[model samples]
Target: MNWYVVYTKPKWEKKVAERLNQIGIECYCPVITQIKQWSDRKKKIEGPLFNSYVFVQLLDMDRNAVFQVAGVIRYLFWLGKPAIVKDEEIAIIKKGLSDSNVSDVSVTAFQVGDRIKLESGVFSSQNAIVQEISNTHYILVLESLGCVLKIKYK
Candidate 1:
């Protein structure tokens, strides 16, 4: 059996994985737990690491069976064929997400000349160029306003 990638409906990764499992199909959905803060309180919740995508290990005969499950959109194709994922790649993804300190995993790595946007705070929605990186802050040069701001890394 080989691992193949399947696309699911929006926010339906878990549900689709469950349905596939119930039908005796093996599937893997990598998720991570994070603390979500709201105005009233904070709660730790599990969310998909790869949004709307799930991996399934199966034979060629089971292809149609997987598609029949609810919330399953279609198979992820590459170069006119269904993309086959390597077992080692999937294992690495699972192991990385299973770590206790997954929160420290940087989703995006910025370089010296990369363009980045401030997601929150006073400079929210503003674009800036990465100039330097200190141990605790990012020195970004905002060319539009002609100012350099050293924003603390969250």
Candidate 2:
């Protein structure tokens, strides 16, 4: 069985993952705990790390089994086919979340020449220099990865 990326309805990642697992399908929905403030109080709430996305592992023929659950939009596509997530990538996410050494993960505004180190994801620990910035995204030149990365934000 291979891991495939599943796109879910907005804010449905955790619910969809729970439903898929209830039916015996292996699913992963990474979550993070943050302090959310309202007029009354500041409370710690857990939320999905990747909004509207979950990972499911199943055989190619068993792919349709996920659709039986609610809020599953579709398999994320790449190059006209369902996008696959490598097992190592999934492990990285799990390890990052479990490792207490990793902290303060945030997407903040960066200047054109600021140097930053990625705290999570595939590029964790890699140093990148900001090359460009915009309202919705930023470009980084990852020296160690030897690649230019464009990250979209809102």
Candidate 3:
């Protein structure tokens, strides 16, 4: 059985994983506990590490059954084929997420022209491309909205 990535509907990662498991399909949806602050209080919430993607371990024959699950949009493909994720890489992600010292791992080395998804703030879930990088912040260009934003990472 190889691990393949499935894209889920918005905010459906956890639910889709549960449904797949009920059908005897091994699924993984990595989540992290985050402290969200508001003017009145702070609360810890669990959220998906990758917003709309879930990993499933299954034989190629089981692909049809996986697609039948509600909220499962489609498989992430590469070069006209379904992308396969290695077991070792999945294990590393699980281990790193479970480690107490693992606060934040850089998803990618940000380079100019690389597209990125905003994980939080008012522009949460928006896509932008890196226009420039400074010592402390990134200058991103939101192409669809025709605007640029400077974001600082903590």
Candidate 4:
């Protein structure tokens, strides 16, 4: 079986993953917990790490099964075909999130136009360019992934 990426409706990653699992479809929706502050109080909440995205492992013939779940929009496509994520990549994501050493990870500032290799975190081992930076977040262009990531920080 191969792992395929599924795109979900906005903020539906977790729900879609849960529904897929309930129907015996193996899926993965990586999540993270963070503190959210309200005007009156602060609380910890868990949210999908990659917004609107989930990974499912299944045979190509079973691809249509995922559509039965609500909020699943479609399979992500790359180069005119369903985007396939390697098993090793999935394993690495799981391992990185589970590793205790990653708990203390922090973001550092980078000069615009600097080429950098990510050492850890979700895009670990990937090369990216510091495209832009602002007070709240920074943008990174991961050429290999063919995506621009805008990461926010305190």
Q: List the residue pairs that clash in candidate 3.
A: none
Weakest ten-residue segment in model 2 by summed lDDT? 102-111
- Best of the two (1, 3) by lDDT: 3
Cα-based lDDT for every prediction = 0.87, 0.89, 0.90, 0.90
Per-prediction TM-score to the true structure, in the order listed: 0.67, 0.70, 0.70, 0.70
lDDT of 1 by residue, 25-63 (tens): 999998877788999999998888788899999997778
By TM-score, how accurate is candidate 3?
0.70
lDDT of 3 by residue, 1-154 (tens): 9999999999999999999999999999999888889999999888899889999999998887888799999998855689899999999999999899987643546799999999978999999999999877789999888999987643
Model 2: CA > 4 A from native: 106-154
Ranking, lDDT, top scorer first: 3, 4, 2, 1
Per-model root-mean-square deviation over C-alphas: 11.7, 5.9, 10.9, 8.4
Q: After superposition, how far is residue 122 of candidate 4 from its true place, in Å?
A: 25
Candidate 2 C-alpha error for residue 129, in Å: 9.2
User: In every candidate, how many clashes are there?
Assistant: 0, 0, 0, 0
State how far residue 30 of model 2 sits from its true place (Å). 0.5
Model 3, residue 113: what's the lDDT?
91
lDDT accuracy of residue 65 in candidate 2 = 94
Per-residue lDDT tens digits for candidate 4, residues 1-154, read 9999999999999899999999999999988777889999999888887888899999999999999999999998865689999999999888887887775332354799999999978999999999999977889999999999988765
When 1 and 2 are scored with lDDT, the better candidate is: 2
